[model samples]
Target: MIDYLFRPQLLAVVFVVVLGLLYHRRQPKPSLPDLPWLNTKEGEWFTTLRARFRSTVNYKQSIHQAYDLYSKKNQSCIIGKLNGDEIVLPVSSINWIINQPESVLSADEPHKDVLQTDYTFVHPVVVDKPLHHETIRSELTRQLGALTMDIMDELGSAFDDIWGTNTTEWREICPFETLKLIIARTSNRVFVGLPLCRNKALLEHGIGFATAVPIASSLLKLFPDFLRPLAAVLIARPNRYHTKCFSRLVRPEIERRQKLLEGQNGDLEKKLGDPEPNDFLQWSIRRAQESPYPAERDPDIIAERLLAVNFAAIHTSTFSITNVIFDLVASNPSKKYLEQIREEASSIIAADNGVWTKSGLAKMYKTDSTLRESSRLGSFLGAGLMRQVVAPDGVTAPNGTFCPYGSCVAVPTSGVHNDPEHYPDAATYNPFRFSVERESSTAESPETENDKSNANITEEYIRKANLSFVSTSPTYHPFGHGRHACPGRFFAANELKLLLAYIVLNYEFEPLTERPESKWIGTSLVPPLTATVKVRRRKQNM
Candidate 1:
């Protein structure tokens, strides 16, 4: 009988049966391990497949529904399905998951996967390491106080140019397109600075590249990861368009900086020729010189780095501005939210000799909170702090949720942001939620008078709990958390606050429709592609 069981046909049948079972098992449950899967209307396997299919199809509703179901248990570990793969989503284990060393849960790989950033789509010159993030985290952020005037100047010019000065009447316009121009120009002013930012064609390419990176990534991801490398040969085409364009834009600047640096190689503290141009391109060159790469001042390399910064800065800032725009005028006119913000911006700028300051932006807590709350309502991605278990041993969560090696894990950003436990009346848009948090935080943790006077406004705002637009905490994962969190958030905070302050103080907006809902594709939440907000110029100037 044992020999009979080992017959060729019998063994083949068993192999087929086992393969089917394993495939079905990988479909995952819509609930935790110990619990029977919920959403049983379509049967176990069908529910999983349907949800995964809907993930790419009608995404936002599907993920939110699935997450809501799984989160009801408030379990440390819950199983979810995405694109036919079982995922380990931790609700209560956010800190442990996000803070995991890169060895255990690799964040970079997820970005590569999401961005489809292989030689196929991006050139070899495209960054393998996150040098741009380093530049943003350290150099650019430290200079925000100094760059405030530049951003304000850019903000004023970009808004005036994009929103138009002649529209004294309530003219309707799409928020995304309008804000994209405003954000691109405002961001590039600080990014490349001066004449480069003023180039209309260059700014347009920045927008194009920013938009193309994700679209290309999404298209490439349509192919499996293993195939992506091979696919890049045929499907990807290794587009170096942005690299070529931006390289020309900044090559002269980088060459001048290199010459200046060569002359003043003795010490970094020493003033170099032209005061060492304070912009992203210059910073990239300085960092590259510090690194081991031979192509330290290579214009193409510098442009790739610049493109990365533009992509990050323009994409996030535009949507954030749009979201806040919708939220600002969404409420009843009597709530007087817009009026209050106008009053605040006018009062703050009046005191600052009519100039935007890093410190002055800090006092715009209502504006800051509106940005934060808008972000909290609709985070950039549905799942943030994504990681994949890379270690062979695999790691266990703080709450004892274990993920096997090679498993994908992430915090449900949408779920966390909307949790009623964290935000009361979670469904509603409460711009002042974080503002109140700021005030209550101020009262609970009073600083010494000397401490208050000595601390910079940026430091003071961050020191308080719940006030900062860029505050990174376990509860708030919009910018993510820990070391892997968005390194550019400080600059992002300043950019957003200043832009919104300028808008609220200078314009009046009325929504043409209900609060505009963002577009959801897979895990990403894009601000509605088109939201027509009626706008009129405010006659007052700070």
Candidate 2:
């Protein structure tokens, strides 16, 4: 009887949902961007729900149609309903929308629904504070020069650990989880410092937390906002588990550092007779100590923030690496893509006495372009850089599309990136696409094919054409653009470049029969988890 009628909990949820539906009209359906609706109608309170369900069914088709319709109609943006709320998804004005003042188009507001961040294990300080981003953009980025060697060392160890003793034959591996493990360890080496990053328990807990977020967020969305607090208690157990693990593994170390601070009367490295830890934990601790808020200084709070950093760093970087690898095998059938990247990396590494430095990573134009192409095609979000309008009057775009207060707005990052207007032959995966293009729009002396035969232009030409992985432009926004662009991008770009260079030089992937397409739902773009590539260690490694 219970099975036929569904569990009591499920039945109760249905009853409450029906009640909420009866009252949902109290919520207003404000003006939209005037784009045509799909399977939609007037006076339908459930348009948002139906739209979301339809989107999930064939998201690529739906998004492509939306992009095309808006483009054909010459609209600035398209209005779409999602999860019972309206959103302004900008098409022509992506750059303008992303750069809008957060006071008007607030970035922090969207996560309340998307990630359920307020109710999850994510610390408010991590989300609200500017310090964490400052740490990434300034302090952590400054240390990357000194930290490169450590990252390379961890990278080698991670490869060995995951790939194992098999060296001779082609061994098929799951690019999905394998790449995550590689990126997780390498990133943690920088975030947590040695030993702990490799600790089975610590890595497990860290990866577990990140892997649990989307699941938790999705569950939280099943309930209406007023009931989410209760639902969060029941459904957010993974977050609780992650919080306990982070506190357990990391809080002790934070306390020890605090004791050291007290023992030395606040001279952390000076009195310890050693250099500072040169890791995120120590960096965060120092910054936390300087915070005006007492909550920011708490050890548990510090652990939560560190986990948040891990969450951001690992998810995007892992997909990026995985996508590029899949593209290397699946997209490049001629295998020239592999040879070019391998040659570039090999030549650079050989010049540096086999040490992959920050400078060395910079010169691999082909490898950098491969990652950029992957990012454009398979970035973490289909439409992101979301902002909520908080202004009493909301705001209007440069194109004069008004986003009302209490409504959400976003840019079609994927649409813009994939558009032929921004990139010629945007549908094709050309590994060296950015390598041949001008590095930036502002660059005065962009090299051209005509420069190829001019010996006088040699180094200058190479320099002009080479695109830095961190460079952001209005058209290319995997990391975003303007003031609020990703701060950790510098670290992320370098990490992935080095990691990819190593893979390119040391292994050859057996191409897949078809291109592995990424899955899209809501705004999230998930990589093909079932994708596999056959690879073998090169003679040098063997």
Candidate 3:
């Protein structure tokens, strides 16, 4: 019987049954530990039932609501039953948890399920050894940094192609589609480079891979823990289809480069001489060679890295760009802000003598502020800076509540960013708030109380002023913190800034909805999916 159970075919079945039994046995029993805050019989009974169900389906929202309730009551941390898991965390404990060393609290585990589902192929790439992560991160930074100019050039051309001058009518369009194309083009410029970026089939595959991975991840989350691994295996082939295409497409190029390097000074020196390769494939091949892994390792590892880059670049850039457009349409006041962005773009272009350089792209401060504000308001995830509890430790919440080890802590970014305490009149949309703050301060001047007051001048401003920028410590994270903060943030910002600048310079927009409210589902805040927006080319005064 033991031998039969150990067989590969029976192993998964047996494991599933054993896990289900364990889950059943571990289900919270009656006469649960008393939770101090639940004074009402109804509240206590509901809490007990929630513990028995062991579901996190509505847990995130419930946690937020609980924070508001208990926070007002002068309570810092609240112990609640989420699905079946016991959660004892303070609303203010994020800073403490994030500041702890990775050895004490690892981000690797909390995000493991999500990462494993959406990024199975790349798991080996990141977790194989320390060198793998370093190689990919370092190479990606170098490749993206060098490709900034190419990205800007492509943005200009792509803008003209999609919403060109000859089109006179203001048509209702999907911002997601427009942003999707822009991201696909820019990402492909780096991923495969040049001619392939223009290939419709390949571009479709790239976009499909980006969309599918997230959907797969969400679906995988619903299954039992043991079955998730099997589900990943079932879904991985579809995900790998794109990887297979990438490898086949780039293998010949890799071979040609290999020959050139072998014939001359050898591959290593050749790659080092021009370390900043425009093509991600070349960059990956060079880095893989330099990696500690033996050459005998499968070449698919390089393909996996390329796929990982595609996954990172496409979805994030697309979602952010879509959100910006949503805000533009929903908040019609954004038209004036768009015009300001246009003027900045026009000035930069003329100053550069009509040359689009990386420095010129960097000068679009208004565009940057607009994109940043949009991200602030239209944040895709509710929780910011997620870290897993590796070993237990004591964490003191901002409100002075204490949490023991093995507790997950998250920054209530939406709460912090939207709070009236930090930002007076917090609900109003002010696209230029950051720009105004920057303008008020000088290069060498210390931030005085007066300047800080101006920084939080409005009720809304006050709320957000105290909220951490990306440069702030891990506690106040929007793009995360520490070394693991989104490495592609600079690149993502540039792409969105350029795209928005082009649209503002070339087009005019009017909202379909009189008063558009962005929809918040789970942690993501999305603008109206089908909202109509009228657009037409800007009339030139010669």
Candidate 4:
């Protein structure tokens, strides 16, 4: 045994193990806030490690426990996480958290850490310069009016091809799996354009990349910083492969656009009688060219940006719509409520001359409310507005809790959405809650009728604005809240609303006897992937 232990390979393995231990020990630990820990006692290193692993599985329960025990009482508490421990602040601190400067409380750091974007995105430049967010926030939003018809066109074709045109019988379909493809295809129609969006290989790779990133990110976080790069080379292989596939696919388009830009002397819009393409690819190319970072301009990185946007859009919309389907069906066991939504959708579409438009989709208030209600009840994350302390000394909450550098702070999003103080009968699913609120606002209220003051105007504006699915507040933040709210929410709202409207108008769905319970995978409240619904094409014409 002594001789075997002296062997060179064995000695080398031991040496590496020692080095790893040392590296992990030297890693900076967050000076977490003075808050009571939920479900775990803070003690020695082993206890903390044990809590972290336990929390990974019990996160859903732990969050609710924290919410009830402390958050509801206006207190903060610490909860263990796979990535690290997080300070779960009360809903009252939401305004305070969002008001802080980015230097002190950074919204981007948590995202970068959680997604492990440095590796998963295929390059650091992708995370460092998130021009895609800006493009989505500005150009895509501005183009929504124009893209509405294109999105609708894709949804119709997607449903026909995937869901079928059979009016004779009801077919069982897995919503999660089917919606993923439909969303990927429909989103890509506006992302790349007609032919490429329909490319079987491209869509597969895009979906593969989206699926791989989260899995890779989760695995990468389990490793120490020193081992992550080496681990990522193996773990993030799928991400790299998909990024390469994306680069190969988009290189031709990038070259073609680059030549066009060069021919027009760096301004495609400036050229006479030539209208620039209106797609995400075009938008990203233009945005990338404006950057000084070489990686940002590289065709490979540009392609990765397209996939990054895909990663953000696909799973989120798919999950949301999946939940909406289950909620819409289960809530109306007799299928009566669906007809009300369908009538709203049909009437709105007919009023818009048989074409879906931004304004027309917006008028489907009941449809919007259904989605909003679903979001409130079935949030993907237990918490929201997550921020990492970046200031050297750390920042203090309005209630005087100190969170040092590296500590993450977030408000209980799911908890707030279900809080009785915020949402009455919070346990029940009320699909038309927001629409009712909107309708009530349009009529004369005591506040609006008796008061013509500026404060009352602001109050009325907020009251009306808060009802929309895209709008976010402390109480309703599936898309997050404050200035850092989801940039793609406007586009997501349009696409989802149109998709829901199309389904309601064109198909007849059999309501579920009971809602399928959603599962919690760490922090994500995942809708059942295998959940199926029966549907048949309606005989009536649109």
- Give residue 108's lDDT in candidate 4 (0 to 100): 96
Candidate 3: list runs displaced more than 4 Å. Answer: 1-63, 70-92, 127-146, 235-237, 263-276, 295-297, 332-335, 392-407, 440-476, 515-517, 539-542
Worst 10 residues of 3 by lDDT: 31-40
Clashing residue pairs, backbone N/CA/C < 3 A, model 1: none
Tens-digit lDDT track of model 3 for 1-542: 11222347544544564556567557543322223432124545566445433324443454455456654354543334322233334445555555678876667655554555434553454433434345445665555446767877787777667766654677666777776787788777866677777777667666666666765565455455556666566545456666667666656666666555554445455655754345666665666655576651345555555566677787777777777776665665635766676788889878988765656765565666677677776666565665555554544455555444555545555665566665567677667655665434333221445775454356554433333122333223567766667666666666676667767767787654664556765345555555546677778611
Q: Highest TM-score: which candidate?
A: 4
Best by lDDT: 4
Candidate 4 positional error at 98, Å: 0.7
Candidate 1 per-residue lDDT, tens place, 1-542, comes to 11332346543433444445555556543332343332334535677556455555655654565467664455443334444343536566776676678888898877766776665235444556767777887889889899998888888888777787754577778888988888888888887888889898788777777776665565455444444554344333324565466667777877776766775562434754336567777788888888887764567777777778888888888888888888777777777888888888888888999877877777787888888888998788777777877887777666556667766677667777888987789998778887865655543232445665543535445556545788777678888788877888888888888888888877877653477777776667878876688888878655
Residue-level lDDT tens digits of model 4 in 214-300: 888886777778877766666677888888887798789888887778755577777635788899999888888777765677788
Candidate number with the higher lDDT (2 or 4): 4
Which stretches in model 4 have alpha-carbon errors above 4 Å? Answer: 1-23, 41-46, 266-274, 443-461
Each model's lDDT comes to 0.70, 0.74, 0.58, 0.84
Error of 3 at 310 (Å): 1.8
TM-score of each: 0.85, 0.88, 0.78, 0.91
Worst 10 residues of 1 by lDDT: 30-39
- Candidate 4 yields a Cα-based lDDT of 0.84
Off by over 4 Å in 2: 1-19, 28-35, 38-52, 76-79, 82-92, 263-265, 437-467
Question: Which should have the higher lDDT, number 3 or number 4?
Answer: 4
Q: What is the lDDT of residue 83 in candidate 2?
A: 56
